[model samples]
Target: MKKIFISILILLSLAIASIVPFFKSVVIEDGKTGKSLAFFDAKQGSEFSIEYIHSIHKTPVREIYQVHNEEILQTEMRFQEFGVGMPSGADEGEVFAQKGENYILSNMKRTFPSLDIRIGQIIANHTLLLKGHEYPFSGLSEKGSWVSIKVDNLNIWQRLIGGKKLG
Candidate 1:
């Protein structure tokens, strides 16, 4: 009886260990429908970014983020020129600099549980950067729709039925 109990405990531990990897994912879901548009496997400290062209300035801007504490933390930003909604200088606990033509803001501590973004109908050219690959927003969802980006732990069934991976 003792040996049988030990074997059962060991098997249970192995089952849990195998399911953990399926839990960590970066989920891009439709805000209105609550359907996952795309999901990709990621570790706890992985980083991803979104790059888009400023609609008015027509310059480029990139926002870098890191997965931490089961949330997405906006860590840095690179942009060209100052315009509406553009940061002129670093606020408290932030570092600002300029590298060539682009201005960079680093060491930012903004945290968001999820981000709701509206894809542009014609412009903005939103792109997701992960693992040195680029995924255009247009390909993830339709134009002018809202998407919520968040880090979610999906169960095995959810992960199996989830949307296409970013890769």
Candidate 2:
């Protein structure tokens, strides 16, 4: 009876441990605007989308990015310039848009020189929500034009075990 009880406890603990990481959340911010673009509940291989807007030649431009595994896999840009002052050669009924893969990282790096964003690493700072609780992160990284805050996978075990008390 004692051995059976111990085995059951071990299995239960393992089950809980495995389930904990999925509840973690990620928060992404646009440093230039000082606004949060997305709050995502993410796992190691999960995907999510973020949107940004800019202006060019008095035209409003919007871009949506698809992020997966800490990498931006696709992007779509749309230019909003519908009115009497539209460019002379522009297509009146057509939307100006462009999309491709592996473009965001380089663009972001060039645009936000202070942030120094990389392709594979997650950015620090901003709020991380895990299992309905909020934990503000403060780590080393220059605030630039964009930033992403995600639960550190390397510290998942610590987060899962210590999160309850911290939260």
Measured by lDDT, the strongest candidate is 1
Model 2 over residues 1-167: C-alpha lDDT tens digits?
A: 99999999999989787656444444444445434443444554443322222222343433333334544432333444443433223233323333442122212211111221221123322333334554443322233334543332323444444322232
User: How do the residues 1-167 of candidate 1 rate in per-residue lDDT, one tens digit apiece?
Assistant: 99999999999988786577557889999899989889888787789999988888989999999888779999999999899989999989999999999999999989999988888777698889988999988898998889999999887766777787775
Off by over 4 Å in 2: 1-8, 11-26, 29-38, 42-58, 81-146, 149-167
User: TM-score for every candidate vs. truth?
Assistant: 0.86, 0.33
Scored by TM-score, the top model is: 1
| Model 2 root mean square deviation, Cα atoms | 11.6
Whole-model alpha-carbon lDDT for candidate 1 = 0.88
CA RMSD per model (angstroms): 3.4, 11.6
